[model samples]
Target chain A: MRISVDSDRCVGAGQCVLSAPEVFDQDAEGLVTALTFAPDPGERDAVRQAVELCPSHAITVHDHGQGHSQGRDHDHGQGREDGRGHDGVVVDDG
Target chain B: MTGAQPRVVDFPLRRPGEPFPPPRYDDYRRHPGLVLSYLPNGNRVWLVTRHEDVRAVLTNKKISSNPDHTGFPNISDTMGVPRQEQIPGWFVGLDSPEHDRFRKALIPEFTVRRVREMRPAIERIVEERIDALLAGGRTADLVADFALPVPSLVISTLLGVPPADREFFESRTRTLVAIRASTDRQRDTATKELLRYINRLVAIKEKWPGNDLISRLLATGTLSAQEMSGVLMLLLIAGHETTANNIALGVVTLLLNPAWVGDGRVVEETLRYHSVADLVSLRVAVEDVEVSGQLIRAGEGIIPLVAAANHDAEVFTCPHAFDPARTERHHVAFGYGVHQCLGQNLVRVEMEIAYRRLFERIPGLELAVPVEELPFKHDGVLCGLHELPVRW
Candidate 1:
């Protein structure tokens, strides 16, 4: 599974980083921007919370291996995305 | 369908003496006992105006403040909203047990001792804001200059709300509090924006542990996500809006009566006379109880008019005028009884320091605009000056 953050909603309050330090890091402006692991199998729980705990409902976690059944969509605000449909393959964006 | 209605009409819902006049409600003083007809929605309700009656009703649990009851009227209808807009959600609407429990959880954080420990930090925040105000020039809008920043800095620091998010909260609060929003659409829009902002902050606090109130709550797991949002919403509204209004109006009161600035008696007098808290917390009557010979049925809403109570002649000799030396220990500014404001101590210390430093730092401080020209949050449940322009 992989995670992507929507920059518009992030307030840079550093909450995402606190939930999952291994997965997210804050930029100079204090906005959470990127990931530490390409395919961090060990940090799945932290990544799940990092998305759930975002106040703005800006982060999305995508899962690839188990088809549509692999990851339950955590109904945050991210609806459908045009990016890669599967998880495991990491999409790196700053 | 219902039993015979009580003699609600005979209660004489109007004040008795001369009106309070401009800058003060003209009709508030004259007919202290007069119950004015006020409708928050389509439901007809009576507003109790006299000090004694308001206090009696506010402290009485028999008057239900909750919106779910048939007797309780919806105040959010003015904004044309379907569901009632729970402005200060959580305990603001609760009665007795639920109110007591939720408030108890956070009471320790706001105690005199806890707040006193924050004095040095609060003082520093005040000094910095003052520096910024003076830096901009000798003259400034007292609302923006002093009133706005004092509580903003204090609350943000205490809660560990990030510094960058401060501007967002400030802007959203200003928009939401102004009762003068021309249309219901505008008011609703502002409300949604503020709620969204708060929800975002809540999400952040959950993940990131800090020394703020939000972080503390997240760590303990005492409150659910919904409950936490409700409480934070209360803090955002109560913590800053009330304090900001008090500071603005307090400055106006002191500047108009300069003697009150330094005189301990006068400051006390100003607090009573020009109370920033125009209305008292809403109390819902849980059961039918008779007060002052009137049997107000169960579930009816009772609002304690703090302004009216402070001026009750039965309670004080000359109630209307601002007299700092009055030795009366009982004032309803922070309210009376068990559910009084938890942040009262913080508000008091902040106001005292703000006023003391304001006048001392700028000796010639005086209003730049006429009192008549100044704006106020007149129609709001909690009323005070909107902008206080001053020059030294």
Candidate 2:
């Protein structure tokens, strides 16, 4: 799995690092720093959870098998049916 | 539906000096997203009690944070001060691109990295306050001696306010935040004085820039004098006020629940249990929207009872009990969505250091007066103790 972070949109909520510390860490300012763009198979699930829980939707994940990337643009103005967002992004409010 | 009018619960259901009332928790559990009429003004509003519903209302774009909208729920008469008449730069009341624009400019200054870099200084401030508290005999008013000053000094250091002016800003901010304690005239006077002081500081910064937030903002040349003053006032007041209360309240909570005194989870649980700014996050519906199966019409107001939502039994098991072991960190104590608090990371660091050091240094600390005898700040926008007299 490949991962990237949009530093411009990050508010440093620290959800990413909390969820997937192996793949993501925070700089001194609390902004997300991608420690590993390519994660081992064992770390994929945690990475996915981090991407979904990011409050700013700053984390993006491209699953090799899925052949598509998931990020902010993919989710439009619809609220998340599950009632959870990338960190607390509140998917429905977009 | 019956012909009888639906029960109208007061907007701010919690009373001063009380944990969120048990009945309110029951109300939230039973009616997660019920529309109830707010008292006094009688504005129709959705009382979002469930955590999920509260998140939905907070994050909904259709729900505007702009308090200028008609029919917006006003929890207190003091809060009803006209928007235009009130001091500007309170971005909490703005919506959309306007809120985003200002928030964007300020985000970099509060990033985790920046807060982490300041941790050493914050630790030093916390240590110094403890030192002062110890030197002042065996008894002290925790609020004045330690709780209030630690964050006050930290914020002053960050803003680059000269040490000589620290006492002035601190006193003004105390009056400004204590809406119930201070008369409206006093509030107005304090605000005007603070704004004038910031403006003078800004002019000085223009002539001789320094390595501080004010100088940095002036150097950008983005905000006008009034705008800059407004931002500084908001930061100055907000910087110390909430965290100060948290520190005091957190100590009281830890003393009551000694097992959780030094636990890191104590901070999260304290924030969740108290939810200090209980009724302030009022949003007006700018467009028709449905949340938690309720259709809220446009122009209606919504008040997310954060303390109630935090105690919702469905999300938190045994919600009423203070269980620091529970690891659910999704509490909306600092708010959520686009307007989630900008200084939350800093608050976490401050609280963690404050609690750890206080307990480690003064393990025998105990309240001098009974908790019931302590004065609780009821009239203010935030809920906290007026003074916590304590001894070791």
Candidate 3:
């Protein structure tokens, strides 16, 4: 598994560091820095959870073994990508 | 459902120094995302207890933060009145493009990197306050001597307010946030005084720029004088008040559970357990939305009962127990989504350093008075001790 973080989109909430400290560490400003590019098999679940829990959706993980990348990339104006796939779920009550 | 009398829960469900969630909060959690009636104005608001539901409503774009919106649940009669009467610069009460614009502009100043750069200064501020406490004999009021000064000075430095003016700002802020403690007249006077003070500060920054937040905003030229004043006012009030209360309350919690001292887990759990700004995440449903199987209609207010959600038994095992080792990171103490507390990272840094250093220096620290006799700030918007008397 390969992991990458978008610093531009990162707000430094520190969720990634809390979730997978071994694979991810934060700089002085709290942005994510990968400690190990290829994390051990045992750390994959945590890394995946970190990616899912990032409030800004700033983490991207490419699982080479599965040949798929799981993450979303969008502008700040776009709402959060919770991975629920319900982009337009909210509607006007009127 | 028209004429049905709702079950009324008092707006602030906990008293000062009380264990959070009151005892009956668990009963409310059983229904998950049910709407409960808030007695303050008889407004029916969706009380989201489960973690998932709280996160959903906070992140939902259709739920508006504007207090002017119809059905917005006002927690107190005096509260929200100032905003309703005039234009509000505090982005906490705004939504979308406007909220994002203000937040984005100020984000750089609070980023982890930026806050890290401010660490040395923050550390010095902490040390000075600690020094004062130690010099004033064995017994001291932690709230006034240590907790309050550290953040107050740090924010003062950030705003470039002269050291001479710190007392002026601090006294006014104390009045502004204490809702039930102060009358509406007192709160309003403080609000005006703060605005005038900020306006004068902005004028000073304009002529002689400095390395402070106000000067940086002035350099950008994106905001007008009024807009800049509003933003500074928000930062000044929020920056010190919440962190000061947390520091005081955190010390009390640690003293009670000394085994958790020096544990980072204690900080997160303390925030979750107390959820100081308990009812802050109130939003008005601008449009109909379905969240966790409940269909919330338009014009209805939604109060994500953060204290209750943090204590929900399903997400947190033994939710009421103050176990510092619990690793739940999804608590809504600082809120969630676009409106999440911008100063969270800064607060965490301040708190971690404050707690660790405090315990290390005052190894024999203990409450000066019995817990039952200590005064808690029940009349204020933030939940914390009014005075934490301690001895070493």
**Candidate 3 residue pairs that clash:** A29-B112, A29-B113, A93-B288
Residues B204-299, candidate 3: write the lDDT tens digits. 999999988899888877787878887887787777778888888899989999889989877788888888877777788888876666767788
lDDT of 1 by residue, B85-188 (tens): 45443776776556655665575567445677899988898888888888998789888667877887788778776778877766666665555543666667
Better candidate number, 1 or 2, judged by lDDT: 2
Candidate 1: CAPRI quality band: incorrect
Select the stronger candidate by TM-score from 1 and 2: 2
lDDT of each: 0.62, 0.75, 0.75
lDDT of 3 at B304: 84
Candidate 1 regions exceeding 4 Å error are A1-94, B1-46, B49-52, B76-89, B178-194, B264-268
Query: TM-score, each model?
Result: 0.69, 0.86, 0.84
Model 2 residue B92 CA deviation in Å = 1.8
lDDT of 1 by residue, A5-89 (tens): 7654453434456567767875533355767434377777677656543534456665554332212232211233344644345
TM-score of chain B of each: 0.83, 0.92, 0.91
TM-score leader: 2
> In model 1 chain B, where is the ten-residue run with the lowest total lDDT?
B9-18
B1-392 in candidate 2: lDDT tens per residue?
A: 33334456656554655554346656654853465765566678777778867777776778888878887776666445433334466677787677765676676677666778899989998898899889899999898788878877888778887889988977777776555567879988988898788888889889899988788777667777877777877777676879988888899989999988778988888888888877768888888877766667788888887887788777888877888898566688877667778888788889999999999999999999998988877656677888889999
* Candidate 2 structure lDDT: 0.75
**What TM-score does model 2 score on chain A?**
0.73
lDDT of model 1 at position B203? 89
Name model 2 segments beyond 4 Å from true: A1-9, A17-22, A25-33, A40-53, A60-94, B1-8, B16-18, B78-88, B178-183
